[model samples]
Target chain A: MSVLALSVILAFVTPQAGSTPAPTAQSRQAGDAREMTLTLPHALRKGETAWLLVTVGMIGHNQIQLTTQSGKDLGNISPFGIRSGQAAGTYTIPVPAEALSGRRLVLRLSVPQAGGLHRATTTEEVTSVRLVIQRFGNGN
Target chain B: MSIYFETTRRDFLKTSLATAGTAALSRHLALAQAPAKYRRYSVTSQQGQKALVSYAKAIQAMLNLPADHPQNWFRNAFVHLMDCPHGNWWFYVWHRGYLGYFEQTIRTMSGDPNFAMPYWDWSDLAQIPDSMFNDVLTPVASAYERYTKDLQTFTAFIQPSLKNYWGKLSPAQIQQLNIRGYKTFDDMWNDVSGWTPTPMTGHLSHPGHFNPENTAFAPTPIARYLTLQNPQLSDSVKKNVSKGTVYSGLEPTNFATTYYQHIPIANPIKIGFNSSTTASHNTAPSKGTVFSTLEGLPHNSTHNYIGGGAGEGSPIPNGPWGNMTNNLSPVDPIFFLHHSNMDRLWDVWTRKQQALNLPYLPNSQQLPSYEKEPFLFYVDGNGKQVGPSIAKEYISMSRFGYDYEPGYGEEIIGKRNLVLAAKHPTASVEGLMKGNAATLTLSAAAIKTHLDSDTATSLFALVTVPRPTENSPNREFDVLVGAPADATNITADSPYYAGKVAFFCGMMHMSGMTDEATFIVPLPKRKEAFANLSAAAGNVAVTIRAVPSGGGASVLRAVTVQSL
Candidate 1:
């Protein structure tokens, strides 16, 4: 948030606010999200906890939101126990059993600088994303 | 932007001398006499090891600077702490600018006219160069023990100056912080303190807010998580930086498109070489932005592994860890070498895109806001403030007058790896809805295209989920398709597992905005997922369901399947 980064490939001069072109097209429909589908393994037993390991680039704080395909709005996923984003990018998002109950599911996640209020118009990306099932109650 | 004028204000002289042939000569002669670019060599080379000696000298000088000085080693790390972006398109360009200027500082301080930063090229040399473990090259050395002896000493030495710097920030920087969700200086400081007011004083709390004690203010010698005794990366980390993974890191053709990967994989997995794009370099993860495989893979994993944050990029101990794990990473000498590799990978990816005759960067039209985004915080070799520079200035290594010594993936140069355009990519159908499950009936033609080895069109489920609200109780949810009833949570290993959707909680619910949000999710491409469809069939029935991540109700508005 402290810096603004743009890839001006064709021009070197910084454009004045009004003179800058509108985004030509969005990769997706609404926001800046570019998604590549990944496979999800591991199953959670009742009341079990799982870790959503996401490799982030540099933003300090991130937020991840989840929802069921039935459109169940789960609030921001809590950090696995006390471990949140310790590094510049590695985040531990704990997914509890209540959220993984159904035979099938759909979720909407956002690991934000802090996802709230302003529409996310900034440029950002994530690297590796996966869920680690916590069979024991120790590591969050 | 012709820096040609930088040579001299000889406009009149050039104009008078420029005959038709002279004009051509001006172009070709300048071309033939290309200036010598600084060469960043691999650490394994003698030249690179020599550069490390100078790098050590420069780092020591920066460390010796007064705490109040902008070029002080800690304050330089502050530049990264304050401005670096991860998980976004600017990830590459921002770092390029950071490194370019830092390299200049090294040149100036080390007194080496030909000095260029040496890169670790982790794929080639998996262990840290033994030279880095010696003297000032390691953060654990005696030189760093002075300022970073402990939190009390560090806080006493650095806080006052940092606060003064914060007080001096321009209004524009403050405004950017506002959009980035830091409303006040206290908000930013709270992240350092890891103390969030229960009620929301500026909403500064983040991922590990649940921790009673979360702070990044400790950077002692002990804070160096990896010692010379354990300098090797874990086996998993070695895999992350393996040659094949680096190739995948260079695979995405588009500079940026979707949050994760907007386009289908070139080879079932080969999309998103670069990270996704978003609004601000520091913007939160939204529908528009997700992690590119490279940043999410090698870069982050490497940081965590060295810092021992996650013990090789998985769940490890919740760490005070090392400086490498936190925003204060540059405190460790290894940080520079690690970033050099990251920057090198970006260079390789850029050249690969250029060789394929594809756009290596986002055209202005793709992200209009890009050009206006100024990188405001950087210190130059003379210890002078170097920005408000924009991203374009650092988009190419040429901007910094440097080039990398040949390493892995440089082979893409002059090689013609053809990429096939999507053919009949527009075939799609609607998915019939059931409880959390959608039955998408596909035609034989749709199945064939999806199954095509050469021109496989990626299938995505445009799932409609609720928009993020500060009041929302649920933050994360898992998605699974055709899994058994007992199989609820899933990871990448499971074929029936779809993906996980997460939200940043803690924002006020927007009023009058659309309540429903649509996400373009790529369908899993595992052959096992479509085994039944091998025979040409009229249609297939697949059940996609949403698992409540945190105890919450299901509310899927609709699911549309499309191939692109």
Candidate 2:
């Protein structure tokens, strides 16, 4: 049994099988989550105004909305009476350069927790950041 | 890849010039021997010669500022967007404005007092020498021969505009921009020109324009390391930057929604052993590299591997990462100062002085219920819980405060689970119920309460069942409490509970008996909360469980009958 102990017993009896594993905690724990897209920051221009950090910290007792698929309500991040054992803070919101054009949008974030017993959503796919509209004296 | 960028560009130019000569010999060696609470300065101890005089006084104060001073177009579009791609956020705001212009030119050469910048060891480039990337006073071996003579001015201006906007790519996206995108040369000269912020020391100098018949060929040694340090980022125009990869930094399971993933503000009581689940080593495939056992890789432990390639089984510069803009990992911006010193040691083991480092049980793997648990961690998908075990989630570590002191070994010791206890030699555990003899209570009688919580609360012993237990198949129960004295305080009145203690037991491996027996116990100690009142007298012991007998100890109706 040598050849480096039969390649460490066939590298612990080989098993690449269908591959794609490694991510568990019961597969990223439930209702499944993993999505990212954040383009907004060219000093954010157009209507020229920026500031929208918004961070609702795992808000669970419900309340955490944000829209714009023409549904517009791009606001409300309450996170209720702070400190229910904190973790979510930082809300700046103000952005309005024609509410930053589009190329695929959706920020949604609702959360309903215990008092309501269930209701969780966390969408975020914001691609809108084109900006090069300068014009003025044509400093190009 | 040129020996992993000649050991990460010669240990990031010799650990940013030996942490700018250990922040100038830790200012005449004092802070009583440099480990924490440090803040000194005075620079001349010449190592990387004050990181080349703090990179020529932060490129002569961002080339003398003015041109519409919004920090001179964010220091001229962050040093011409340090030629894009290294995992975006404008490569972490151009590496927090080039490490805030090398921590303000090392606090204007030490005259500033709050020093502490030191890191770049890049695992001692697995033991140095390759003429440490042909020296040239290191900016990664002069940006690795200026990224191999800016690959013939990026094949004559970003290969005919990235083959006319992304049409000819695969060779794994040009070897993912040469090993995990934006493999530097000031990010492939910001993708062959176009990221355009042309200025030479500040104001707005201009050297811009390109195509002199593709810059009259013949320059190489990476076009003399990009015209000797950015001759206004030329080499012809075409743009599209954003080069961050090696899986692009910070994602230790979102680690409490990223607000400082592993706190190390100056080693505030350090300890970062996430050891990425059980460690081990020796996989080495050599030069295609892959050396496993730092727990078989994936940002190898407590995070940071970014945009990939340790190829042949991988593991090279793998740690102290930062680039592609999650800044901090240019060989250790104390890798975000050792995860903010292991998030302030789980905020000092859950928090103290006012109390509640709670948790004495329930971390469920649910077997024959062999308890000793505590240490939970969830973040989104609605299960909220964020922190509840590092002993009961914070109330003070002097309130997120940070002076950070303690011989810098980055301390970390907390995780023990190995159970079994049974003490009835005399502490008390007599029985014979229904026929009369009730003494099953508890608030704290002997095992002086200290299993620390984040969620599992129980302390039982009660009796009364006229008739149950199908003729006993297993019921060995014993988990009593009370022996207090070393500085006693069971409160609700304590005379060692007047008589009958039995503080530990569990042998009930499942049987179907009768009459009555309830023991869900398993507390042998160390989930921790000791404020040391003369080490709180926790003498007696017990933890045996074999239950299944007599109507399955219906959680012994949560005990509390008193009277001896």
| CA deviation > 4 Å runs, candidate 1 | A1-140, B1-35, B199-214, B259-270, B285-288, B312-316, B418-564
- Kindly give the stretch of ten consecutive residues in candidate 2 chain A with the minimal lDDT sum: A1-10
TM-score of each: 0.55, 0.26
At residue B116, give the lDDT of candidate 2: 39
Model 1: docking quality category: incorrect
lDDT for every model?
0.56, 0.25
Question: Which candidate ranks first by DockQ, i.e. highest?
Answer: 1
Per prediction, the TM-score for chain B is 0.64, 0.25
- The count of backbone overlaps in candidate 2 is 86
Give the alpha carbon lDDT tens digit for every residue of B110-145 in model 2: 344344333222211111112222333222333323
Q: Give the per-residue lDDT of model 1 (tens digit) for B76-97.
A: 8888767777667787788888
